[model samples]
Target: MFRSMLVAVDGSDIGQKALEQGLAVARAMEIPVHVVHVIQTAAYPALALSDLPPPDIAQQALLDALYREAEEILAGAERTAAAAGVPVTTHKQLGHPGAEIIALARKVGAGLIVVGSHGKGKLGRLFLGSTSSYVVDHATSTVMVVRCEPGAS
Candidate 1:
């Protein structure tokens, strides 16, 4: 039923599953999908590293790396959609993962958002929250969470 779907990927195993699920939904609905990857900046407090000054060259290098990674992710998604015979578009954003995802969903006017519940670990998630949870809490659009079971090859 979704006309436009926004899928978020973080290059994690779980994120890959989310991509697969999102692609399936998009294909079934016969709607175009927009795949987005957010290059997270400063994920956690670097109490020790914070003492170091931000280097211009390092910042530029980080940006370049992020862009390259984003392009690869989008390319993979594009190939998946192509194989599924579904229409697809892509975007790459550099910001807080949660905020960027929500913002892009709104900007795209997507009817739904598909994201992974967590990016890493299996049982470790019992303590930490996931991007999917964050998006579900903050996003205005409907969110679909794909739970990628651990050890699923």
Candidate 2:
């Protein structure tokens, strides 16, 4: 039985499905749910690439932007969970997606961690190694994954 649940959301339809799935479980258990979104710096695309080394300021700025994006994703998840009558908290993390998710799970003392099979990015999860798959294989806590077919909206 899960007393606290951690839902890792990334704004993809699959991620939305995972959020809904986690929300249902948390509501059934009448326990708190924590929604997390991570914008991994490595996952982010470089901007204005040039022969000249990019300024450290530019790299930091890009990271800042990614964190903002992460916040928006978590905010949307928070609103969705609240509307569904589930008490939820949101967090934004930066790092490898899998590592950040597992770290957040531990931080929240969540007994369960949930994630989607694929993200909304151009690179398919098979290539990037689905965050859900990684978490399920590596996380210390229990994990639940909701998979959506490729090309699903």
Candidate 3:
């Protein structure tokens, strides 16, 4: 029933699962899939307080590395979608992962959003927060959270 599907991949093993699942759904429904990899700036706090070099230089370096990783993640998603014979579009965003994903889903009119749960225990969630949880709570569209398989790391 979805017009389009948005698959959020963060390069984690569980994220890979979400991508595969999303592609399968897209293929079944004959709908295009949109893949988005958000570079969560807040995830890296060390760079914000680096005393080794100018803050701008350190920040830029971190941004560059994040973007490279994002590119690789998106590329892999695209290849997977292609092999599944599903049409796909990819987005690289810089911001909070959950917010960027929701915004892109709305912008692309994606009726379904597929994301992966880190399954970081309660303690981990308390300290690091969970992107999948945020998306499920804040997204207006349907969200499918792929749980991390036990021992899948």
Q: Who is ahead in lDDT, 2 or 3?
A: 3
lDDT of 2 by residue, 50-94 (tens): 443654886878767777778788888888898999988888876
Clashes of each: 0, 0, 0
Report the C-alpha lDDT of model 3 over 1-153, residue by residue, as the tens digit: 889999999888899899999898888899988999998867787543435365577668878888899999999988888888887899999778999999999999999999999788789888989998899999999999999877665
The residue-level lDDT of candidate 2 at 43 comes to 55
What is the C-alpha lDDT profile of model 1 across 1-153, one tens digit per residue?
677999998777777888888888887787778999887765523312436566467666766776898898888878877887777888988667778899999998998999887445545545754577779889999999887676552
TM-scores for candidates 1 onward, in order: 0.81, 0.82, 0.89
- Top-down lDDT ranking: 3, 2, 1
Clashing pairs in 2: none
Task: List residue ranges in candidate 2 displaced over 4 A.
Answer: 44-55, 119-126, 150-153
TM-score of 3: 0.89
Best candidate (score: TM-score): 3
Q: How far is candidate 1 from the true structure (C-alpha RMSD, Å)?
A: 3.9
Which is the leading candidate under lDDT?
Answer: 3
